[model samples]
Target: MNEMLLAAFALFVAYLYLPTAWLSGLRPAKPMTRQANHLHCPENKFYIPEDAVLRRHFVSQLRWEIEAALHPRPTDSILQRHYDALVTIKLEQRLADMGCLKPC
Candidate 1:
């Protein structure tokens, strides 16, 4: 049947690919490359301060937490996150002051 043939072909392909350990030993060792730890959070798109630069802020960390608690989805870019955080902080301060000021 077609199903049986397809299943057998898949198994054959998997068996051929799985034992790449033997092939690795036959090739030259890779040249030294930057270790994962040295690089900034390249893979973690959500990581704050994704790259190093002048005036780079790791503020995304705090912003993300606040956004997660207060808003959904969060901002994508560092600048957007920074702006959102600033707006949230300022609004909170204003609200706090307004609360303390008895009926105007």
Candidate 2:
């Protein structure tokens, strides 16, 4: 009786844990891809508080990044300024794309 119980438990464990390829045909999984048009937040899904500190915190980070791009380290070569300008341009373009900044 003990041997029969052990065999049953082993069979149960194998069926529960083993990956059987034949079961794949029952339901094939597909990867989910985002639709190009639905990139922006779905109309009011979340509400961000209009706190002054929070606003200043986010603005300060952006300001610091622009400032860093505008002024490279003294040890860097003059060519680094050109790279910085390109970085700034790309940042502005992305901000424009996200509707955070208005392009002239």
Candidate 3:
């Protein structure tokens, strides 16, 4: 009985280690390709005009701020105010996009 239990335990350990060893051997031997540089346009071939890019960036920033405000972990009143300000800014941008408000 003791020998049987020892054999079973050894088999279980081997079963676990065998799959891990196999998987490690099957994994890619070489490193993956490096990530693309997101900060700048690739080779400067494609570009958005400065004014439009600035407007888009502003709208994106406001959208991000609004999202962050919505998920405030501590639920602070100041965060709520920041969210409201971002929403107001987004609304103004929308109005401007529709030509209802002149850009200042």
lDDT of 3 by residue, 1-104 (tens): 99999999998898777867777887788663342344333432433234877868856765676566665433688877776786777656554454412221
Best lDDT among the predictions, by candidate number: 3
Query: Whole-model lDDT for model 2 versus the true structure?
Result: 0.59
Ranking the candidates on lDDT from highest down gives: 3, 2, 1
Residue 93 error, candidate 2, Å: 0.3
Per-model CA lDDT versus the true structure: 0.55, 0.59, 0.60
Residue range 1-83, candidate 1, lDDT tens digits: 99999999998998788778977887898775544444443432332223565114434444455555653544569867776
Q: For each predicted model, how many residue pairs clash, with residues at least 3 apart or on different chains?
A: 0, 0, 0
> What would you estimate as the lDDT of candidate 3?
0.60
Q: How many angstroms is residue 13 displaced in model 1 relative to the true structure, after the best TM-score fit?
A: 96
Better candidate number, 1 or 2, judged by TM-score: 2
> After superposition on all CA atoms, what RMSD does each candidate show versus the true structure?
15.5, 10.7, 13.2
Q: Over 4 Å off in model 3, which ranges?
A: 1-74, 100-104
Candidate 1 backbone overlaps, count: 0
